[model samples]
Target: MEKKKNLLLDIDEVFCFPGFLDAINEFLESNYVLDDFSDYYIDEAVIPQERFNEFNKFLDSRNLYENAQILPYAKEVLKELDFIYNIYPCSSCINPFNIIGSGRLFADKYNFLISTIPFIEPEHFIFTNAKYLFKADIQIDDRLSNLNENIETCILFPSYHNKTISNDELIKRGILRAGYDWRTGWLEVANILLDQSQIKDDKIKRYLKK
Candidate 1:
């Protein structure tokens, strides 16, 4: 039997829609949605520099994933992908604002993934910001910078921050965009990876080569 490929899958924005934005809204008493900001760091975009520390204080007092909901089709598609790829849920859990207490996130996210996705072994969980270190057959992440070149297939899972990225940029870097809408990104990913025949097709093949 052929060995399953290694898949480095991102947790936040990819597997689960984290509640950071919601938290920001709650803290500021302002209703700001995904489309409100194009920056990956929503707090920086919405909150003033003077209020940054206070925002950090607010984040420190709560579990960021408390309201996080798994992205649509994430579990179903991941379960199917698990049959062909070893799913490693890699996440960057550090709360940069509260670096000293960032360890709290590790446990919070770990428990969340364990309770939500029972199919993946706990040993496969990776919590690190240095994603470039992991050499896998496929790397799916919302952050374009996190998609390392060494990986055979690099999929940029669309998020608010990456919406402005041009197709030319992705094609030049041999990366594929799952789609622009985070609501249906997982389904798009399933289409791209589910069929082996599609991998060798001109579009996928063209991007994978470079």
Candidate 2:
């Protein structure tokens, strides 16, 4: 076997959809959805500055991270990718814009994976803003800011908030987007990143790697 490929997978938007945004919409009782993520920082994009206190309260009261719905194709895709890639649940627990007064944001995310994808070892979980620190063949994330020039292939997970980013800009940054059709996009990711030599073995791969 060749060297084990490193794949950095983001949790918040990539696998765990709507995360804090879902909680905020429910707490404010607003119809705002993920598409409303026009601004990079969710604070400026979604909630008003005045509502920060209530936002903190909402996060404190509910285990949003633990309860947030998993994105479609996430479970099956990750399991499939595991055969060809060392999956790392790379995510940032603390919101940079929000003060994060309530510690639930950090702890809940950790437990969220424990409950959701228990197959991914806890040691592979990373929660930090320093995404560039992780060495990987490819990094999948929704936010472009988390990526850098180092990672070989930075696959931008398309979302409502990031629809406006132009293709030229993404190419300039050496980022690849699989369009908004995430289910197909994920399969494409597995195909593109999976080692080509494993053609015969890929077919025989089981859902749960033994």
Candidate 3:
């Protein structure tokens, strides 16, 4: 029998929307700083140390861990996928502190918030600078540039940050074949993966019943 393929899912933006910059702008405004950091989108291609530090400060100061909101349908999608495939939560950290300390802190906070959800596990998590190190069959992420063509499948979850890259451009670059921006799309992803998983289990039955 062939081994089961693993599905790697990104946490931030993909599952939880960390309102880090937004929260910073709110805090700044309350403190009388008129500057709006709301328009700031972390540029994935560029790694500016100063800008990174500023971003980290924003996360640290505001206690952003509790503020992170799980995207709509994210829980349902994860539950559905878990029934069929080996699901792994994979996320990349921007700041050095995030990779070392902040990452674990954020994970702990996230797990606490979503503790009501029984299927989500902390041990199945991975924090890394290079996501490619994990040999996954599929990776679902919001950034198009991070997609590795050598991987089996890369699903792009559209976001405001990636406005410059058109869907056609993504396909042309061989980054992704299909993209989605809402929970409905996430459900479709679950259905696709579940249909592929050969496991005959109660979870699969429950999802099918729905």
Candidate 4:
């Protein structure tokens, strides 16, 4: 049997969409969506500088991943990919607001992944803010900065904050752009990693729905 290549998969925006934005909306009582911010950190973008501490306090008191939305096709595609690649779900669990209580996030995120992706081994989970420290055959992540150059295939997953990254920038860095839209980005990713010829048109069409 051929050795399956190592794939470092980011858990947060790449697959599991955290409820930070929802928390922000409820806290501020402002109907802000993902498209409302150019900044990577949504709280930093909308929260007033003066009330930042209060906002952090609000966040610190809640589990953001308690109701995190699992991105469409994340489970299905990842399970497919797992047959060909060893997937390691890497995530940054630090709460910049409450570093002292960051350990709780580790448990929260771990339980989420464990319950959701039973295919992936619990031992394969990696929690750290510094992702560049790891090297693998492929790395998929929402933040361009977190995609390590050492990885053979660095796929930049589409997100609201990273929409500004041009194809030229990605090409310059030898990274692949998953797609412009996050809704169906997984289909684009499936085309990249899976055998394109085998991907049924119907399968692609099902996920393209708005």
Candidate 3 per-residue C-alpha lDDT over 98-118 given as tens digits, one digit per residue, 9 for 90 to 100:
544465555554554457346
For residues 52-158, write the lDDT of model 1, one tens digit per residue: 99888888878777879888878877877887899999999888778998988998899888889999999999999899899999999999999998898999998
1-210: candidate 2 lDDT, tens digit per residue:
887688899987778764667676777787776665566566566678898777776666677665676776577667767777788989877754445553667788888888888888899998887887888888898888877669898998877668888999999988988676554555555555554444334442332223
Q: Count the backbone clashes (under 3 Å) in each candidate.
A: 0, 0, 0, 0
Which whole-number lDDT from 0 to 100 does residue 138 have in model 4? 95
Which candidate order results from sorting by lDDT in descending order? 1, 4, 2, 3
> TM-scores, in order shown?
0.91, 0.82, 0.69, 0.92
- Judged by whole-model lDDT over C-alpha atoms, candidate 1 comes out at 0.86
TM for candidate 2 is 0.82
Residue-level lDDT of model 4, residues 8-62, one tens digit each, is 9998888978888889999899999887777898888888999987887787778
The all-Cα superposition gives candidate 4 an RMSD in Å to the true structure of: 2.9
- Flag regions of model 2 displaced more than 4 Å: 97-102, 182-184, 195-210
Residue 174 alpha-carbon offset, candidate 3, angstroms: 3.8
lDDT of 2: 0.73
Best by TM-score, which number? 4
Per-residue error for 95 in candidate 4, Å, reads: 1.9
Model 1 misplaced stretches (Cα beyond 4 Å): 196-210
Superposed model 4: Cα runs more than 4 Å off? 196-210
